[model samples]
Target: MTSIISAVPACPQAPQAPQAPEVPQALLAVEGAGLTVPVVGGGVVEYANLDYAASAPCLSDVAEHVARVLPYSASVHRGAGFASQVCTSLYEGARRDVARFVGARDGDLVVFTRNTTDAVNLLARALPATAGGVVLVDLEHHANLLPWRGGGRRGTGDVRCVATQPTLEATLDALAAELRAAPVALLAVTGASNVTGETPPLARLARMAHDAGARFFVDAAQLAPHRPVDMAALGIDYLAFSGHKLYAPFGAGVLVGPADWLDSAAPYLAGGGAVREVSTTGVDWATGPARHEAGTPNLAGATAIAAACRVLTALPPGAWERHETVLRDRLLRGLGALDDVVIHRIWPDGGEPVGVVTFSLRRHDPALVSAFLSAEHGIGVRAGRFCAHPLLARLGAPGGALRASVGVGTTVAHIDRLLDALATYLRVGPGWGYAHRDGQWQPTPDDRRPPAWVEQYA
Candidate 1:
């Protein structure tokens, strides 16, 4: 692969360069599965695709799994064809796999939706009418918060929004106070901060929620890929996550929890699969997953997600943890040395965090930073509110900050590219300040074209 460098001004290097394991070429292989992004050139398009918090790349195993089943696609359950039987078996098998993936209890229902947002919306709509006074963290993603807020607008109850504080203890204190003051139905919190990558105290929060007689729904979108999750051990009542974030890249998600709420409530989307029977006067809703999966489900997508779970299970947890920690620390150290960069968080006391790091460039819009990284340096990252508008608004970061999220396939070279870009951009000072008429950022001529390697996959 070629190392592509843009025309940004240069800065002095630090005294030392950290020594880490060489990034494996096999892991960087995104070939053979269709995409032709090249890996060579002086301006080697070094893809530091650090946006795993939003979506991770599909694993080779997942792609193969989908391919193996694609030829057998047919309508499941209703048709008696051989292909249909295979499809039905694979789809249901995927459900069982998901159940095991989350450590679901016997008879726990796994309802597949398009994504975490859809799963959360399903839960929100299904909660009993008496589910008043839901508790939410100020740091929650829009998908987790919006459903409840929208429902509250219909007069469910006083939906309490817990304010942020200096520490987790303080935040928990405020949450406890809110739960005590009202009849709370549920407490929704993230397993990790998408912005900070700091995982919340799930066990402690779970115990607290149960003690307060409220169900706990954890948004594990970020944590599932980095670590193992045992919902039963965590004592969470409900759990939601997406396949795309788990290296599956499929339009499938899971909402697993206690069956009472889901069973009694109406289907989220009124359609064929959800109804057991229909008459002129009324309709009977099926129980468990069928009730919520109203339309034709994405059987292949579900299989891919299940395949991702199996692939992740084969990985050595200790190695995965060690590698990610080293990568994160290396990147943090490099970014920390930059005078203009302000990182969101670093575990000074040596606490564990996921492979996500967020920051802001001084006196610059985050979107510009992201654009320069991509257009000039061949590094892809996400910027802006990241769909957590409330959290961004609370932090007063209206345009949001540049967020570089890593994953299992990421490497040290990728991190180096990001640091080098930042150092270069710092010397240039908000490179090319003219705003486009369409409200988009237009980088200089040097940044207009993508790196040469990108054409390999184009």
Candidate 2:
């Protein structure tokens, strides 16, 4: 019995697992978190999206809200089904939400359009026939300038372009003088410069416009996302903004103002929803938002935008301002450290700017730098006139410049990565050859594959 017995070998104990590195909270969580991009050197890295000025990444909350509502989505206004009723309620509710967010007055009307450009163009069409002149500055975006210049068949009065002064106060004074000299019906200005991120004194400008018997209109596309806009409190007669620029990249925009001009003018579009009755001989138009929101509306877009406004408004006061200020200061300090980097700014006294910084390298092409950032590092940025050609010409960079804009989802680490990449590019030029074509820089003999999602969609 002793000979038959055998002892079994003892099994080794399992090794304890190593600790995982702590994951830091984002400066602001947004959709596309931890997205990876393929670099030109055959490796994938986390994508750093810094092009918020052009189009901000959708907020996570907004995306979730849309997803939740998609199941119950239906045509808004004219349906008798339960889904239709829900959709109608949601659409109307969205209008109310946006109005509350901007502090719209009692008689103000909110009309949703495709984008800021479309919203401004709609307003242009609605300009009063009695308006003798339309005054604007050279620093305005094409959306703000071109609409007044060509206001469809209504003709947007005599267009007057005012020159921007070195100081904000001087610019306001010049604008006031022009307003006083001419019978200007409207004084259109950007709440914040899309090119320089410099915010003009809105209250002062509003007063000047009113004093000269002109209605003050603000293109708040750049200002609304960074700062809260109170249309009633600020004495703004009309305001326009795009949802794409406000962390809701749905194709929708808002033009909120008094209803008199909009209602008096012809419907912006001749279609089903715009018309209350249409016969072979003549047509009677529907009133309120339906007059301009022709055909079936983008219910999802409006809802998503409303969700974004709600999320932003719910945040603790000054939370976003504090976060962006810190990031802006860090970005400016980093850029200032680089000797060859020249930042384009409007104010010489270093006035407070939003989270947008435009700059140009001493010896490098802006397009090439932007391309190199994407190819070498996974950083995304915008490099061009930024839709402000006149402003760029005045700033002495007609060729163009690089813009690294920040918003929700942008982090200090992203800014550091961009600055470090710029420094590296300055120290040692790009490893790959690039050629300028069609006003853009592209890598020669490009061999990088598209991301998996793009490939699947394609």
| RMSD to truth, every model | 4.7, 12.6
Winner by lDDT: 2
**Please, what are the lDDT tens digits per residue for candidate 1 over residues 41-115?**
224444567777888888887888899999998997777999999999998899888888888788778989898
TM-score to true structure, per model: 0.89, 0.93
- How many collisions between residues are there in candidate 1? 10
Best by TM-score: 2
Q: lDDT per residue, candidate 2, 190-286, as tens digits?
A: 9888887888878778898898888889999999888888988989999999999999888999999999889988899889899878899999898
lDDT of each: 0.76, 0.83
Cand. 2 Cα-lDDT: 0.83
